[model samples]
Target: MNRKKSLQIFIQSPDLHQIRHESVTGDQTLADLKRSLFPESNHRSSFYFTLHGKPLPDDTPLSIPQIAPLSTLVLQSRLRGGGGDGGATGAESRDCYLKMYSEKKPDKVDPNEQRLSKWQNCALSNEPLREPCVIDKLGNIFNKEALVEALLGKKLPKEFGYIKGLKDMITIRLSSVPRAEDGAKFQCPISGLELNGKYRFFALRNCGHVLSAKALKEVRSSSCLVCHEDYGEEDKVVINGNEDEVAALRERMEMEKTRVREGKKNKKVKGESLEGSRLSGTKHVMAAVEKASAKVEVNGKVSNGGGAAKRFKAIDVAPAHATKEVYASIFTSSRKSDFKETYSCRSLPLGRN
Candidate 1:
């Protein structure tokens, strides 16, 4: 034990999530730390120390930059996996020794601790959160690739039906916690508070910058504090919100989609109406011109001093706004032909009679 430099150790063997504190010198080795956690055990070499989910070399000195003071270090056993064991213990000894030990089965990993370990994993696939991550209105994060695969495979759950397409969600850029020592995973850039569900956090849709709600309210600015990007009230989304908070967000999402659909329908109706009016106007102008050009005879008198009075037939064009079924019938063989298909030499073809 040394008083000069101190570090925090989190061993997860007997009791999970239980942090054990032990002071060590800069020149001390990892083996020494393992012995402190299990002093009575002669199987000290059977365990190892891990930092940031990576196992350190047995001879690694604690003076390195990565081993920051008060930073957490996890203790893991060297044994890997097990299966095919009997009910109580594997007395055959042909099976792995881990199964043969009745009293010393591998400690069960706490469910909450498992979730904390997978903090950066995708909510849908439970895989590592990769680039192109998407956040729904309820603030649940998911991998875009995993979502696409699920959609294509037709295996998406009914509860996730709210995510109709990419339009329902927004992409967010998360900022990792800078301090490696703390148990927090993500952090608020402005307040520098841990974003481990303890405090309220919001990610701006305009800039994807995540900041604590306290910071945004204190400054009272319309732009993101981190990137200074301008944003509207609709762009702000709560991260990992409570039940009531998420319900409000879901209602807002539905309203926005409804407004957009209404706008599109209105545009289509306006366009169709304009085209219909133009076609009808053209037909009326044609009828007026036919009357103006035609001459008529009255009481054996020449009209408009013309050499001969004349009559003109009205144009026989079909209406432009016919339905598909009527339009198709216009080209059938039963319809009257305006001009006959005269044969050149009174024969249909060489093979015809």
Candidate 2:
């Protein structure tokens, strides 16, 4: 018996449209379903399908050899005629509002303002405020606590406030942070970046706001005066260490390295003949301790970044083996069998017929 390949596809869209269709044959194209999904529209090439919520070409081949079973299919249509071959320049013809303005004013007073005017009424009243700050060069010290506290009062989420500069005003400086005795995790308030150690700094992205650790301490609140959000020490997610703990760890590592280097130079001279001595012993001990402790530290990290979604649970079978029998067995059997049992047996005497 020849196996028939099939697929189960799920369709999703930004306009809140969702559909699920079982592909009975591998030869089926998305264009076939587009008709059922859209009856009145002859412009089949205009709308695009989003598989798993990501835009994909409609003519893309779904199945090979047209023989497979146990597949999942999702059919999604573009919202009210959006994606098309005309591209951005031709988009104006589709929107009546854009066409009206384009005809009314072939030229505008301010090009920037003209674009913004077209997008009127799209602004959100509850939009968040942003601040600017810059990082200094290395070896610079800043009061992170005070800076975060002041920024928190501005009603902006801690993640939005980041380092920025004017004419190279934004300088980044590295400083040590206190660590918890056991271990702890920290997240940068400005960038929402997570780090294992108590202290670390890096350049910020996608933000025009900038402030340094030192200047942030002097400020009482975020520059956005209307925002009155306040942050407390307790609001921070504390780990095993404070800034001091991190400082000590850094110092220890530094001292060990310095001693080892000195010992190596001394041994190279005619005065010291010993290769594996006190310095080597100390280095070995410290390395072992650091490794053991790090192994046990909490691995905290953000799961979602860059708007990527979690991976879908997938079967272990190969794409070619996913045929129609396999697809139906996975989903449709339960629904079909349930319906047959109830409907085929009759509707148990309706009250009024």
Candidate 3:
């Protein structure tokens, strides 16, 4: 067995229940850790690790790597790669030059000349010019896919992977389709590809795609993905009549979902509702038995707490030949709503309702 060292495995899932132990051995590789964390579940590959805020690829080489020690590992799925290798279209080249020269040029450099210098570097990349990994105004990493999606309002990939990171927030791919101006076509903000409703959403591990509505339904009643609170309902307000109608339908479905959730909740409320019902029927069989045996109350008699004392009753059971019949009688009537008052009196044999 590996030395018993304490290691903290931080999963990206916002669900507290989802995070768990790896195996009995506990000491595991980055790869083994990922696998053990989700044995039967899908989506195991897309996870990458970061130690102390520096992103590390899953395949990172570790020599005498620290294992089984709590060093703070966070699961992430951010895109991998750096910026610019020449090869830029005229528009991109101009933008890059202007951005570099006007905003970032050193004090000694002329902005126009700096723009020209920056443009030359982009012209060298042979690959059909890709977007430079620029930082957005918000300081967020700007890749081609995200920029495209932002420029066009819509999702990038109809089918894309998502993961919940350490802070209890979800991270989704930047490849969704953007809402096009024409209202008919959806283009990817990143790849600039056309998107359709048929696309599916998948796990970060590329498990598969799911429908947006279906996904929303599944997650609607859980803790808030952003705030991680008891509030799980969609908070957005409908802005138009058509939207209001759709919202009403969604609300109806949500009410049904809430009902089903409530049913499960009731099932787990207490044993009194279930076992107590059965015990009431069992009293019938015991009634006759008590009649045959002498009643004994050592100290105090059983009472219904109503200031009055009631005598205990018992059931009479026949010999082996009739035992099956007795059992059938008890089982069948056990589930009846009025089993206690109706068939409970031996003198009265009330049949099915």
- C-alpha TM-scores of all predictions: 0.52, 0.19, 0.19
RMSD of 3: 27.0
Q: Which residue runs of candidate 2 sit more than 4 Å off their true CA positions?
A: 1-3, 16-18, 52-54, 64-353
Q: What is the lDDT of candidate 2?
A: 0.38
Model 2 residue-pair collision total: 54
What lDDT tens digits, residue by residue, belong to model 2 across residues 1-353? 11234343433333544333333445556666676667888877767654323344666555633312322233333445545776565333434543354368532233333222222111111111112223222111123332344444554333333322232123222222246232222334443333332233323222312223323344545341123344442111212234674455446546755898898887687344454476788898987765544432122333442233443222322255576456546755322442323545643334533
RMSD of 1: 16.1
- The local distance difference test score of each candidate is 0.68, 0.38, 0.38
Off by over 4 Å in 1: 1-119, 179-182, 295-353
lDDT string, candidate 3, 1-353, tens digits? 22333323334332243333222233335666666566876767666665544455555433224432223354655334445676443544543553465346422323333332232121111111134432211112224444444335544233221211122112223333344352223233323433232322221212111123334345553433333444323332111114454557456546856898998888876666778878987997686565544444523543242333344322223345565555545555433444354454533246653
TM-score of 1: 0.52
What are the RMSD figures for all models against the true structure? 16.1, 40.3, 27.0
175-275 per-residue lDDT for model 1 (tens digits): 77765564766778778886566678888987777789999998899888888889998989997678898998989988988999999999999999999
Check candidate 1 and list the clashing pairs: none
**Candidate 2, position 42, lDDT:** 84
